[model samples]
Target: MNTMTLWHITPAEFAVLAFAALLVGFSKTAVSGANTVSLAIFAAVLPARESTGVLLPILIVGDVLAVLTYRRHAHWPTLWRLFPAVGAGVVLGTVFLLWADDEIVRTSIGAILLLMAAVTVWRRRTAEKEEDPDEVTTRAGRAKARSYGVLGGFTTMVANAGGPVMSMYLLSAGFRKLGFLGTSAFFFLIVNVSKVPFSAGLGLIDGPSLLLDAALAVFVVPGALLGKWAVNRINQRLFEQLVIAATVVGGVQLLVR
Candidate 1:
């Protein structure tokens, strides 16, 4: 594959990428999972494999903004428990990417997004019936964290599509809006930053890709600020609904495209 320079992107493609970058920022601050749409958009607008690389830096920028905004509300114990499993999953995903082609990457991401959406819906329904929804002390709870951690790391490594997976886990664990945003903010910031070396090693992060990222990054700032303003007005139920709806839409778009 050739290095993707700024000149390679037409004006229309730049418009689409800019919009996707804005969504990246908005998803970070308001609806944590909603950036699946941005993922799909980027994949559609660029090469599927290359898109993941381009999207990573934008996501990291959003992660920084999110940490600055919601850092105080993070759940440290939960993050600690999940990191080891997530690291393993990242390794698995990296191995998978070593040989996978563009079609495989795109299909896997689409399928993962759809499956996560379904699981989240089911989990939410079952969570209402649990005796202690907020506790993660049971054997089942520990297993669930490991499960989500692995899946989150894998999807994120492959397609930058881990947001919905973590969102599902947090919601199922009974987090409120602030806690959800804050915890996820820290989780993604740390995880996305950690992936930088791996992505660079894979030749996914390079000069031309970074050039494109530099152009699109400015749009993220305004989108994040807008998200900060909007998040305050959005109720919890509506927030969760938007996240799920975005995930489904992104999945369908990726599959059909």
Candidate 2:
């Protein structure tokens, strides 16, 4: 977990991962769906399965920074409704991880990311016609939450690709920008922390990954600071479009990589 223990990466790969970590923090605070760029970069820089393990800790650091900054605006009811389905989905993802080969993992994850990115774009276009405040109390709303939550949990557990799924869900539910970020921050911090045990159990995380995570964690601070500064200046609609665009690009990279 120190400088001496860190190995298995070139200077270039380390630089790439560090920049990806910065994107993790920036995506957490400024753009809701842009973390797919970091996900694709991590998967590109490391072994596909190992990348998921390495990136989890760095994501938690970003999540922590996000929650600290936006805790007050979180909509807890939506979080509460999503937890059960998400937990089930996480367990399913763990099962898949334990049995799948590296190729299977890569192809499945790549496909899922691409599909989710497409879905996010479609939802953004249709969001204007959806009802306001699609809370999860009603049966229809609960079904919607369950669907998105399960997808979010599985994708997140498998490839750290849940941001766009949740972004689409929240946008469809009529949350303003701050509320969306706050809820997402809380959701990911708790969920990513919970995945640690499962990841270690699957042998996906270990000493090497931890050391790598430690080295990348430092870059998150500046990324977070810049995100906090930039969020207010960016056009919210434009930012969302950029995020979806980045998600699509990342998905394609993963697919073709």
* Per-candidate total of colliding backbone pairs: 0, 0
lDDT of 1 by residue, 1-257 (tens): 34644458889989999999998899999998888888888887787787899899999999999999999999888899889989998999999999998788778878887888898788778765633434658898889899989999998999888898888788777778898999999999999999999999998888888988999999999889989999999999998898888888877877888
| Global lDDT scores for all candidate models | 0.88, 0.82
Alpha-carbon shift of residue 152 in model 1 (angstroms): 0.4
Best by TM-score: 1
Give TM-scores for every candidate, taking all chains together and pairing residue i with residue i.
0.95, 0.92
Candidate 1: list runs displaced more than 4 Å: 4-6, 129-134
Candidate 2 structure quality by residue, lDDT tens digits, 1-257: 22342475789888988999999889899987787888878877677777788889999999999999999989998899889999988998998887887677667766776777677667767765654664456888889889989988988888887777787778667777788889999999999999999998977788877877888999998999888898888876876776667667766776777
Please give the RMSD to the true structure for each candidate, in Å: 1.6, 2.5
- Candidate 2 residue pairs in backbone clash: none
Report the Cα lDDT for candidate 2.
0.82
